[model samples]
Target: MNLFPDAVEELRLRTREFIRTTVIPNEPAPGERLNPAVRTELRAAAKAAGVFAPHVAKEFGGQGLDIAHWSPVFQEAGYSIIGAVALNCMAPDEGNMHMLELIATPAQVERYLRPLAAGEVRSCFGMTEPHPGAGSDPDALRTTARKVAGGWMIDGEKRFISGAAGAGFCIVMARNDAEDDHLAGATMLLVDMDNPGVRIGREIHAIDRAIDGGHPHVHFEGCFVPDDAVLGKPGEGFRYAQARLAPARLTHCMRWLGLARRAHDIALDRTERRELFGSPMRELGIAQNMLAESVIDIETSDAIITKTAALLAIGERAGSSLSSVAKVHVSDAVFRVIDRSIQLCGGDGVTDRLPLAGYLNEVRPFRIYDGANETHKWAIARRASSNRRREVEQGEPYRADVDAPR
Candidate 1:
């Protein structure tokens, strides 16, 4: 596939213009969240501009762009912090929308996916739990879902759940002890936030402030739902979650890539306008080195993100592993780009005087979220070593789907 799809060029350009003209001007102040009214207003403007939900399918009242199309469009929306929110493409919701569309039954789609895609309501994915529970380790899941007369009774606690406060519902992952297959014992269930057993705790104070509702702690005590609430097949939650994570990770890269680029642009603008020692700062060799480094980081990041996006589009098994690599590389690269931009801007970068300062705060958290960079590094090394052994023993080229002999 072409690096830049010709068909989505207009939509991508439109999104960039909208973000530059509409969204950036209305960025919420540091430590301040966007009010619901303002969010509604921005969403309306985005819908009117035809850039709303550009990655969602047309059947769901979205722009119907595929993963390839989303790469460019999401990057454009990332230019402004509110750009993704205005376009209704922010995470948890965006990722949940993808999950439901792929696995939700027709009824589940009608009740959950449709409204979410249309931006009628918000949603969250309940996965990471407290220390004693599941955080990073899916096998440590303490949440249990027992089969009941009509449905399942779920009991668990989830922390750092983004958008849980005002969310209409959540896609909860829980362990099913009844299943025979160890890997298949985990299942996903749809639970309405209004359910009696569902309790939303205080919003976690995180470094980043862009996500709606912030991240909240949640408790599910005997949460009951009908059989229809099951997302796909019972005991297949882990598989489905993996499906969601691969693309979600890439989307994160795409959005952050845009933010880093924005930081670079702000830095370049500042350097060009500010003169030091009777010459433009950008013309100075020191400043030129910083600019050159940022350009390399940005280009390398784009190459990895685009290549990974292509792999995902083709349904390659290596896509998942590559996505992990992309997540690690792009997250760190983008962080450097933003950090360099901050240093280049000097005092203005640290202060909220310009967008680079805030972008720095925003991009910093990306390394930890969506599977920590260190975790990805471990996985990458483990997989590479295992794949190499298999190649040596079998005298064959390494393939993504190959599993090391037990």
Candidate 2:
């Protein structure tokens, strides 16, 4: 039986058409490309085609697709690295939209959220910081937002911030009060990127060349914001950030799955025709094995992502546990698939003659963003242990214990 409804299939077909016709034609050659402008044109086309922001609510000029239905649509967009950009569903912006919709006050919504959802402005999250600041551990955040007259002053440096260069505003995280008992004492403030105290320090060259609003090293030199700049409540920053991350990571998995499929398709096409020692490459045992593994990985990734999306739609707060598992599995799977694709292509794979080299470079960061594989594994294991301990204490049989030797 099909898990998804008829609407999902219809949406998938529509999105596939959009991707094949509208998106693919616009992609620039490997070496010749520009920033923001290329993305702008694509966004306009997506808007005109009525496929922009598939996940955002319909009231906000989006399709308002549910999580289950949106997963396939996002996967289709992932087929082309630039597809998400064209559809206005790219990162930082996509995650930022979710946060603003959930927490922004009416005034904040009017000022920031509305423009963002309308695709009139670009934004970024200023969370990840350099060494000695918040990196993997958000609790280590050292950026401070000191209460001042009618507002607050934020001071800190944010590194590896995507979309910082062209962002009209930034959602900044900073320590609110040291006395709070919360594990991670922080607050999120929406700071105008144009503020004198806020500086775009430098652009960080990333492996992915298609990225617009380039990732940059940012410095918040006593940046000031009115009291209303706070998103949600104080001391709730970490909670809100984590909430945004779960869905964001799922979307990343969905997109990368498509990318991996694209790479595998390319490799499969090449192998079918290429002669190897008087035989077709597809006849080679190693080539066949790689292709089979790629197909399995992509299919598995799709199943996990769709199920996770259903969990989120039901308001279950699926958490990092499932998302982390998906992250590690999908990232590693996609990387491997792309690596094998490149290997199959031989010298052409590593060269700019084809897209495999760029695809390989792009998929590499999927392992790090959202949450690194190692960190998520540790968190998942701890959560599993805690659940098992609780179950045993309550005289309930733990699944692991049931399978364990006395």
Best by lDDT: 1
Question: Which candidate has the top score in TM-score?
Answer: 1
What's the lDDT for residue 2 in model 1?
A: 50
Off by over 4 Å in 2: 31-35, 179-184, 397-406
lDDT of 2 by residue, 72-165 (tens): 8898888987888777787888889888888899899889878888889889999988888887788889888887789888899999898888
Per-residue alpha-carbon lDDT of model 1 for 36-135, expressed as tens digits? Answer: 8888999999989999998889999899997866888999999888889999999989999998888888988999999999999999999999898877
TM-scores vs. true structure, each candidate: 0.95, 0.94
Give the TM-score comparing model 1 with the true structure, all chains together. Answer: 0.95
Cand. 2 TM to true fold? 0.94
Clashes of each: 0, 0
Report how far off residue 302 is in candidate 1 (Å): 0.8
